[model samples]
Target: MSIVVNLQSKAKPETTTKLISFIEEKLPAVRGFSGCMQVSICLNRDSGDLLFYEKWSSKEAHEKYLLNIQNNGVMAQLMSYLSDPPTVNYYESLDI
Candidate 1:
């Protein structure tokens, strides 16, 4: 089944702009990644928290993408922008 993933991160206030710019530059890669169906991001200005919503073909697909980025240093770069480690959760759509 396809899965939806949510990643929440609190950006360092001073690095928020850099974080946004980084994502803007990298988003095309993310959107084009295998199994990725859609991606959306929202920010809570008050808390400096970013919410990333994504849809993927499967949980394994998402995990695979994570591994790819981890090896290529994208994960490390992302961590540098955050005040706290990001939290991720996944869910499957419910049939109506």
Candidate 2:
């Protein structure tokens, strides 16, 4: 089943611009990874928070890629740039 991951983080207000810029700059590499169906970054309509919406071929595929050496290394670097821990939720398409 196709998997969707929704992630959000609390960031320093000034950092929002930088954060979005960083995500935009780095997303191509992520989307190019194996099994990545689609990826999008958007500002939360209500909270003005950063949101990452990603679709993968499967939950297993997403986990596998996250554990892979290359992506894991990149993830480590990305984590360091955040001001607070991020929240991640996984879901599968039910009707659409």
Candidate 3:
């Protein structure tokens, strides 16, 4: 089954714009990753929250991507822009 991952990060107000830019720059590579079906970003300027919505072919695929990111230091790079740890949640789609 396809899986959805929501990643939410709280950034320092001063770093929010740079953080968004960094993610935007890296999005194409994310979108091109195997098993990635879609990716979108949301920013709450008032709250300095950055959200990533991603859909993958399967939970295993998403886990592979997570491993790749960790191995490549991408996760560390992203964390450098955040004021606190990110919140990551996974969900399986429910057909109506």
Steric collisions counted per model: 0, 0, 0
lDDT scores for all predictions? 0.94, 0.75, 0.89
Query: What lDDT score is found at residue 52 in candidate 3?
Result: 87
Minimum summed lDDT over a 10-residue window in model 1 is located at 87-96
lDDT of 1 at 64: 96
Instruction: Kindly give the stretch of ten consecutive residues in candidate 2 with the minimal lDDT sum.
Output: 69-78
Q: Per-residue lDDT of 4-96 in model 1, one digit per residue for the tens?
A: 999998999998889999999999999999999999999887899899999999999999999999999999999999999999999996666
Give RMSD to native, each candidate: 0.7, 2.7, 1.1
TM-score per candidate, in order? 0.97, 0.76, 0.92
Tell me the tens digit of each residue's lDDT in model 3 across 1-96.
788999888888888878888998889989999999999988899998888899999888888988999999999998888888988899997776
Highest lDDT among the candidates is held by which one? Answer: 1
Give the poorly placed runs of model 2, Cα more than 4 Å off: 44-48, 69-72
Q: After superposition, how far is residue 42 of candidate 3 from its true place, in Å?
A: 0.5
Q: What lDDT does model 2 reach?
A: 0.75
| Clash pairs (backbone) in predicted model 1 | none
Q: How accurate is candidate 3 locally (lDDT)?
A: 0.89
- lDDT at residue 51 of model 2 (Cα atoms): 74
List pairs with backbone clashes in candidate 2.
none
Q: List model 2 lDDT by residue over 9-71, tens digit each.
A: 765565666767777788887799788999987775346566789999888877777787355
